[model samples]
Target: MTMTEARPATPLWRRPWMFPLGLLVAAFLAFSLPPYLGLDPARSRIPAPTGWYYPVLVAHIGFATVAMVTCALQIWPWLRQKHPTVHRRTGRVYVFAGAIPASVAGFAIALAAPFGPVGAVSNVFLAVLWFGCTVQGFRTARARRFGEHRRWMVRSFALCMSIISNRIWGVVWAIVLTPQLDTTFGGSEAALGQAIAGITTWTGWVLPLLVAEWWLGRSRGRRRAPSPA
Candidate 1:
């Protein structure tokens, strides 16, 4: 590419809809804490298996909220193009203040989730991926491998967005699609709901990551295409 070659156009991620969704999810996560603020198991979403789990959940939501909001900026192409320093600072916050503690608390909550073994295992996997991707992103950045850092950060954000996807799939599949698709999965509608929950628990994060990866590959391929002779 020549110096005169224009930089790539802004990607879909930087658009209004995408980053705003992250902010909305972050707000949702923040509001979620109030119900459990008094450590009232009754008001809590997962019912905190024990007294100890309550605080852990608060921490998880807090940090994951941070991750979601900050990670959004980390990927803005304009930030990369014009404000490398701000991007690095945001990346640090996303990893240190957000992803790491959230993973630990999230993993604990997943272990104690009343949903069942399938949901528990799925959450466990998500927590690990959440932590791993953030760390890898941080490491790559530290090593000056900015391109690799961006890829890993995208994966990290994809997992972070799973919070939104989980709710979406729950509403779509359990509330709408599943009933139309047979609704039984072998049992009653209640059973169908549980089945859909389990499926989305895994698919929520995994599917988004796969989609991001596909987009990244396609964009890279486009960038590498030969200029006309």
Candidate 2:
């Protein structure tokens, strides 16, 4: 038998959770994308003040969707092991057509955020981290530093998926903090909403990145551990 034929199939038990997670991500895209697809500024979740804002916002969302979808394929071990060409192609798409453009637009959006400075700062940090991690990941891959490449890519992917976490945190924060509206936020719903938005936006990406770092550190520790004789 040829080498390819002799290779055993990857067991589904390995990282079984990823499949359902991908499905969830797909479901989110389905629910969230329809309104934005019509190019209607009125449908924007975030305010679109200037004429350029809506178009840029749309472009940012478009490229981010591409990155989110393609990164799933890129990080799938089964696909990478079985079809390296496809993995490489999709990785390129994630980096060039997705993350890069998305981050650039995200930076602009964050800078021009209609909300207060706290939310703007949080989003700007996210955009910068996403861009830096993605570019570093690509560079490491090019230099054949596979270990570092994997680490950086994992960080990039976590940042990419942070929007999902942002949504979850937003709901959680609203539920937990809404009651304190009068006492803590001077009874201003707008003030409370802005505070929650900033908190959620910061925690969304920051918490995920922290978790990713922990996982990466654990993996490295395991790799460095001495095996039994």
Candidate 3:
């Protein structure tokens, strides 16, 4: 048989559970690193505007943590396929516990964001896209369109993962590139860090999401077209 014909239609190891498990590990490390390793230095840059800022920051962190944990559970296919009843129950919890609170706190932080209005607007768009994807995922699943549901869930998970990618890129740039930018522009480390963080945050989250949406839409279009006899 030709290579394409010999390949299995569905690989056994290419299960849905694997993706979420990997994402969970990533999310866990992303949140745990700062507290455990003290590698993230950006915590110092969070401007304390008032007593409320601290509380808001704390809330943002707490909500985001919960959201990531619940997001992993919601997406894990072993739990979803083996126990759909439990999956539905957990899905409700995930939507309420993860999506709503995180989106609200994220928006609040975005408004007072120090990176300026561009960063603020980017964050707002991020939250909206995240929330919209989750809602669509739930709606599509309820309508019993599994393909649409999976597509929406993929979009939702991609945005949810921005929480992890933002920190990863920030740390990389701070450790490697910030010194060069500071020397070249005659700017402070703080300014360079903010610039790098803002750019990475947008590119890491928004660009990939747009690309995924385009690719998925094209695949779905191909699937829907009538095959030649």
Candidate 4:
């Protein structure tokens, strides 16, 4: 088959649904496992770090959960196209219900992070990026700039996925690094785990944002250039 003919005949597994399915599964696991593991936000094993507020912590987790789930729905290409109205409505809900609340909670929680000021700084950046992208997305959509809106929203959604990526990195790093740290420094496994989680949380979010920014910028550049006659 010719290249153009072959393109339209690609298999389902090679389509966008694959990534969305993976994200959905990961988000479900992240949300469900915490409860089963007895990792309640209402209580912390570590003393409430500097600025930890119980109400805010609860709100943060709640918002984060909503954001993660809604994000999964938003990013699925089939759902977005097949149900455009539903997508727009849920996108609104995601902005108001998920993105704004989560960003507020994120900023609050960041101040109390156990890793001290550096962690707080990183989290503040995360919250700002999350909120900025989300707000820009809504603004663009309201103006009927669908392409710009979609791109910005995708960046926002990518930022939200860090919630899942953070935990996955934490688990993997803990498994691999715990023994090494324990043997080398005679530190508790718990301490090693905390260290890994702290580092990964920042890197996971920041790296994706950087990548998304590059992608968005390239897209905008292409859109702005005049087409050849």
Off by over 4 Å in 1: 1-19, 30-33, 37-39, 176-193
After TM-score superposition, the amount by which residue 228's alpha carbon in candidate 1 deviates from its true location, in angstroms, is: 1.7
Clashing pairs in 1: none
Is 3 or 4 the stronger prediction by lDDT? 4
Task: Estimate, for each residue in 96-167, the C-alpha lDDT of model 3 and write its tens digit.
Answer: 777767777778778787775656788888888888888888887778777777788778777877767676
**Candidates 2 and 3, the one with greater TM-score:** 2
Rank by TM-score, descending? 2, 1, 3, 4
Taking all chains together, each candidate's TM-score versus the true structure is: 0.82, 0.95, 0.74, 0.73
Write the residue-wise lDDT of candidate 1 on 1-229 in tens digits: 0011247646665576766775776677676657866766678776666768778888887788788778777767666556667767777788889889889889998988766688889999999988998898888878878678778877888898888878777776666546554534554665665577777798788889899899889989999999999
- Of candidate 1, the 10-residue stretch with the lowest lDDT total is 1-10
Task: Compute the lDDT for candidate 4.
Answer: 0.72
Compared with the true structure, model 1 gives a TM-score of 0.82
Score residue 154 of candidate 4 by CA lDDT.
Answer: 76
| lDDT tens per residue, model 2, 184-227 | 99999889988998898999999999999999999999999999
- Tell me how many residue pairs clash in candidate 1: 0
Best model per lDDT = 2
Which candidate should be chosen as best, given TM-score against the real structure? 2
